[model samples]
Target: MQKGAAERKPGETDDELLHKVGTGNWRAVRLLDYPVDRILEAAGAWKAQAAGIVKPWLVWCAHPDWAVLQQKLVLSAGWTPIVGFDPRVSHVPIVPGSLRIDFNEQLQLPLMYPHFPVELAFMWIDKIAFWHSDFLLAHDMMERVATQFESLPQGECFVTHPGHPIRTRLKWLLNAKDARYWELLGCTTKEASKSQWDNGTSWWMNFQDHPNCPDKVEYERRAKCYYDHGSGIRYWHQKCGGRVRFIYETEIAHGHFTKIGNPDFKRSIPAGQSDSLRLMEQDMSRNFGLVEAAKKMRIEDLLSSD
Candidate 1:
């Protein structure tokens, strides 16, 4: 590998950056330039010295303010943060189990396929689950699903009036799925319908939105494929994954009912955590095929602290 060729790191391939980091390789440490000593060391003291390389993968899922807690866990377990992402997908700023509710309405980004130089953007699906008071946080969560949109307002809102800064901001918020809806709002120009490549031409696609459009069915299928799904539950449970149960009782016009499904809510995540911090543990375990490893690490640190 060329010394500065940006060649893949040892034990890391472009494809398996997540898995490679599951091993140990400190060079990939993201936020390497965060100025821990410069900003956090004195007042908050966030920097950790390494005796050797730290696994960029294998992290913990934690809220911020729990930095010392997470780092203490990381220090003992020999892991580090190569990537981080905060779950701003809550409705009422209050999670059932999680103490704090952070609602960023401008929450754009699907939190998926991060375009940044990140290998893994640690997410707490289970922790974020509590925010799914059905109607409570489901709509907000769907709006901010990184690159996927599930409803009308978010997709239809894509069409912009000329020189509309608000529209520009809305456009900026659009993921490919939402972008397609600009046409559903009555598109005649090429700009609105043109499909773009995500990674390559093989993955080219356009945006979408349709009234009573069974468009979301495919999205529901994808979500069910990744998460759990059930038909025996209430309507909102099936549509918004039971996160926004409030929508269950509401009557939407047309056959918007097809998208509904029982939400796959689970206590799979550990909540009651901090607000700003991100953890690697659950993510690492999820990808590494070790369910108990993350919990053990968190417990060990908690016990060791006292």
Candidate 2:
């Protein structure tokens, strides 16, 4: 039988308990079933520490549910929220206290490339962060990123999660033609053959202080280069002079490949295994609510404008 919370040894801190749980100590398994409110409260407290260390300007591109969820997470994590979206879809509701940047109006790059809006947002803020919409952030994510940034070597342009190990290796074998493609871009053998370093899902940087910061025109040019080459990761690595460091962990849960059409996708929830499925459903419900609210507000604004 596992010991309950009340049975904890005297003077054992929550951090110590969590550490034990992380290390798979049997004594800590009882802590796994914490009440949801307790977890939220703990996360809320951690938010203060995250906010104090580095309050990044978040720039996101995604649909309504993702936008709302991302906004909620960042706000709770103590960061300013900024969203970039296609005005044509226009379904992403205006999140309270968030600045929305319309990618169609502000960015000249093609919609096929998702990172352009992030790059646009990157130019607007001193300390900026960009991440994919499908990621759910851990409470201490920003604090970790900030601490890593402070400890980075001088002249590093960004810090990001390491690219997926399997995919990074497979891309070279699968896309051998990229060898010539890379050479055409004037890449050295080291640069061409280097493992993909940054995954682009979550990264932070300050353009003002970055030694290789490109101007708007140059940024766009490089973006187009990435689009042409079909690899944003490669473009960042090459153009930034490979001055990127990998975080030990991104502290984000990725559901990017969970939807249909993915090889490993599975949507059906088994009995008593509702954690991930329940969260997805809850996010969808919230997203739908926000979309309806935005539509109603948009109609009212149009009537007033007329």
Candidate 3:
């Protein structure tokens, strides 16, 4: 269990908030009944470390294998990547050219919630470019995107992809009760159902089931305030006077851990009792690479191969 996972009562004292920060438990601080922006403010000392870096590329990285490869690809294209990592990830890649933000020293909110980082990025830099570390883009496309974002006028923002809409739409329809799915549905204009918050990701601070959000009004406010990538882009677009645009030039290859493409990567699970033994070594090996390639291989050579 996570440290400081205790149920926080409503109207938590300032002392409690300070203690949570002092303990380096940003996850626990997230569960407190306060706005995320306020929580970020309280973490000023820790978060300020990254505030000085105002880079254009914000790469949200998780696993080392993917991050290493991504760093290679991005650097080869002549863009400086500002990579963000989950605080709890045991292995973070040490790429020389990339600026790294370890959420352990900053706010450890779920990176899946793109709004969190986008908001943070906007605090320091304008006209930012962001994508997942698992994404594979050609050198030409990277150059194109870098040039596109750099040339964006004030009050303008651009997103290269709309994401996998068909799969996401089906997932939302099948699991309408889940609020986590709602964010990705790109339906910010509609009212979200209460069940969506009730059956959402339990660890999310905004969900109805979370102990910190015991009050209906509080949870509702939290739920409504959340935004996924599509909603975030739209929100900024409207806020910036309709300057946001989605440009589809080249399709980016998302290297999903479960899927096979790279000859060095594959996901494997045991035959029976998949749920019970799903976390065994065999299953884990499938998702994670055996060695860190970013450090060993040449960037040009890695990008040259399929």
Candidate 4:
């Protein structure tokens, strides 16, 4: 084997090689077609680290004050919480039973582009469950999922979205198998459709929003490299031969719903949790945001005392 070349050792397992490439020990590997390599490569460039299983959920959070309460609930459930912090926000308070990471450090890139570090979390954790900072799991969430969480098959994923009965019915009627409504849903251009690739392409192709975005055909080719269907769950399921389970429930509460000013917007706050959310926000505002009332006291201030 050549020096500096990443050569597979005798009897080296796929999981071991996955760790190497994932941690940047091997930089980038090619020729050998492994599913792990393909998945991580699709996400982003390699970064330095050692890999090991950490938890079931990767919580991406920007505000520690807001997420601290949610973190406590996650810990009470005996579930591991890995918080992905947006580096720019450093005033996050330390919460127990949670591992905090910086997105800039992990991705080795700036946070200007809207991207999810799913590959990074998947490499360190057994399952890939990505949770937004604003969504708080119900008190009974872990207990409810204990059985299914344990029995979940390898390569399978479980996703939860804003569930509305009426919207769900309309979507089903439009997307049902052999349905004629599919014709009406077809997009004339790739940009017209929302896909996982939107994050990668938005920097260059979002002319109306970005204004400075280049209007070049070259960006389209770049977008294709990250392209996945709007039905990403289905695409990954078929590509990787895994099952994607959509948990249709109203239990997972979205914190933003409580603060939304738009009267027409639908809110999905779980039963009996609205008061808690309001109280938590009030406490944060009174204590953390009072000094810098214009903004708020940050995770840094919360941590400085500790």
Question: What local lDDT does model 4 show for residue 68?
Answer: 70
Give lDDT tens digits, candidate 4, residues 51-143. 353334455555566567545555555666556654444465657667665544533422211123442333333453444444444345545
Alpha-carbon lDDT, every model: 0.22, 0.37, 0.43, 0.37
C-alpha positional error of residue 267 in candidate 4 after TM-score superposition, expressed in Å = 16
Instruction: Give per-residue CA lDDT, model 1, range 1-306, as digits (tens).
Output: 111111343544433433222221122222122221321122121112111322322111223323233333333333342223234222112111122211111222222111111111111110111110011112222224311222222111122122233563376466312221111111111111111111110001110111111344443432222111111111222233322112221221111111124243222344533111223323332332222333432233232433
> What is the Å distance of residue 295 in model 4 from its true position?
23
Candidate 4 clash pair list: 91-298, 91-299, 91-300, 92-299, 92-300
For candidate 2, give the lDDT: 0.37
Worst 10 residues of 1 by lDDT: 126-135
Q: Model 1 has how many clashing residue pairs?
A: 37
Put down candidate 3 lDDT per residue, 55-88, tens digits, no spaces.
4466655556566667766676666666766443
Candidate 2's C-alpha runs over 4 A off are: 1-54, 59-61, 106-114, 120-123, 146-155, 159-240, 247-261, 264-306
What lDDT is reached at residue 243 by model 4?
A: 44
- Candidate 1, RMSD to the unseen true structure: 21.6
Give candidate 3's error at residue 19 in angstroms.
Answer: 19
TM-score of 2: 0.42
What is candidate 4's local distance difference test score? 0.37
